[model samples]
Target: MTDVEAQQAHWAATFAAHPEMYGGQPSAPGAYAVELFVREGCRTVLELGAGQGRDTLAFLRAGLRVTALDYAAEALAGIEQSAGADAERLATVAADVRRPLPLPDASVDAVYSHMLLNMALTTPELEALAAEIRRVLRPGGLHVYTVRHTGDAHCGAGTALGDGMFENGGFVVHFFDRALVDRLATGCTLLDLTPFEEGDLPRRLWRVTLRREGP
Candidate 1:
């Protein structure tokens, strides 16, 4: 199988084995994204890589309509189960973000993702995904994502997967630097990029927020 296929399989198995791998609590970045969504009066949100529906639950609890997408079917299943009564407000889709998103143009008020952009995607793939994100977001819509920066402890510690990517524990990650972050924002106006830490190891991350212009 190709590298992408291998990565996909690995993620599927990983999520199947550990449905709540990241637990139910939303990440700090995700909470902050939700705050921005509320402040911007965003009612519809598209959540990419919605593992275990952690952030999806948070968004639903905030009374926002969320379209959650994840490559792993098991993850989506977990999301659906966790949504329960709030399932009416959540739509789950199984999709790989490296390809064109299965969403309509200007369909969502905001896009939120946590640590999804820093996956095993190449630079070109990242650019394409960014363009698709811009296409799906309405005018003045926000795109908030987080990535492990080059300064992270695991930046170059794992087996090399080419294109600044590394594979560890059957998972591949592409560490991002400032230049890569800038390249990924080709189609949007980057509003803010700040550093933050999370988890027991205190993983260093770059929380990036962008806006699709033209109202």
Candidate 2:
């Protein structure tokens, strides 16, 4: 299998084996994104890589409509289970974000993703995804995403997976530097880029917020 295919298979198996891999609680970054959305009056949201629906549930509970997308079927299943009565407000789509998203242009008021941009994607793929995200958001909409930065402890300490990507603990991650983040913010006004840590190893991350500009 190619690297991409291998990574896909690995994620499928991993999610199937551990449905609660990320636990049932929403992440701090995810909760913060929701708070920002509420403050900005964003009602419709597109959640990329909505693993286990932990964050999706948080959004739904906050009375926001969420379109949750994850490549793993197991992850989508977990989303369905957690949605429950709120399933009416939550739509689940199984899709790989590296490809064209099945969403209409200027459809959502905001886009929220946690640790999705730092996946096993190349620079070009990441750029394409960013452009697609811009297309799907209405003018002046917000985009909140988190990525693993170069300063992370596992960045260069794991087995090399080519193209600045590393395989650590059976997970492949593409580390992003400040330059790459700036490049990815093309076509959007970058509002903020803040550093934060999560996980037992204190996985370092860059929480980026951007706004789509008008034509």
Candidate 3:
């Protein structure tokens, strides 16, 4: 199988085996995004990697319309099922984020993703994804995404896959450096870059916030 295809299969199997692999609770970044979105009066959110719908549920409970996108169809189904009373305010899409997002221009109030930007995608693909995020966001709309940075404990660990990506424990991660973060900020105004930690391994990450500019 191709590298991307293989990674997809791995994630599918991993999700099936673990069910709520990352737990059912919202992530720190997810919770933060909800608070920020609320304060910004964001009515709709498009989450790039809504694994198990943890953050998806958070947005729903906060009364924000959410569209959760992931490559795994089963995960999307699980989100819809788990949505329960919030299902009406939730939408799910199963597609690769590396490609163009299936949304019209200036469609969403905000975009959020937790660790989705650091997946097996290449640098060029990441730039494209950022552009796609810009296209879907209305003027002054916000985009918040987190990524493991080069300072992470496992940044250079395990198999090297080139372009800052490494495969350790069967999962590929693209460890970002500031230069890359700057490069991807093209066509958008970089708002915030916060360094943080997560999990037992204490993965080092950067929570990046960007704002789309009007033409």
Candidate 4:
């Protein structure tokens, strides 16, 4: 398999192995941060690399329209299952963020991702994803995301897969430093950035919120 295909397979297996690794509860710091920063509206929201529909379901529950995109078929399937066949508010697409996402330009009111940017990708690939994100967001749109901080203990502890790739139980993670993320998101205005702890977990993480540059 190619590099992207290999990465996709790894995540597919990871999701299948531990479907509940992220916990069934709707409580990730990134999700909470996005909801807090972005307003609730009738317009649509796009969530890239959505895994198991955690953020998508949460937003749908809050009465927001959401389109959840991921490259792995298993991930999208799991999201549908989690939605229990009644979640008409959520739409699913199996697509990669590094390439052209399925949506058209300026089609979304907001874009949100969680632990999506740092996974098994080089700086160039991340930059491409950032550009695609910029293309799809409408003017004044908000972007919220969290990246695995490079110094997090679970990274490179010999138990890790290799290089910047590591397995967090059922989820494979890619670690990043702040400088790298800023470089990837070169053209956007990083409105606010703050470090947050998840469920009192002992790890350093960042919540980054940005606005699309005005036309």
TM-score for all models, in order of appearance: 0.95, 0.96, 0.97, 0.84
Pairs that clash in candidate 2:
none
Query: Per-residue CA lDDT of candidate 4, range 44-149, in tens?
Result: 7888888877778777766677888898877887788788644787789888776778789988888888877867776677778888888888877878888878
The TM-score of predicted model 2 comes to 0.96
* Top-TM-score structure, candidate number: 3
What does each candidate score in C-alpha RMSD? 1.4, 1.2, 0.9, 3.0
lDDT of 2 by residue, 1-215 (tens): 76666787887887788877888889988898889999999999999988778899999999999999988877787788878899899888989887899999999999999988878889899999999999999999999999989999999987997878999888889999999988988889999998999999999999999999985
Residue 118, candidate 4: Cα error in Å is 1.6
lDDT of each: 0.88, 0.90, 0.92, 0.75
lDDT of 3 by residue, 160-208 (tens): 9899999999999999999999999888899999999999999999999
List the candidates ranked by TM-score, beginning with the highest: 3, 2, 1, 4
How do the residues 15-40 of candidate 1 rate in per-residue lDDT, one tens digit apiece? 77887688888888889988999999
Please tell me which model should have the higher TM-score, number 1 or number 4: 1
Highest lDDT model number: 3
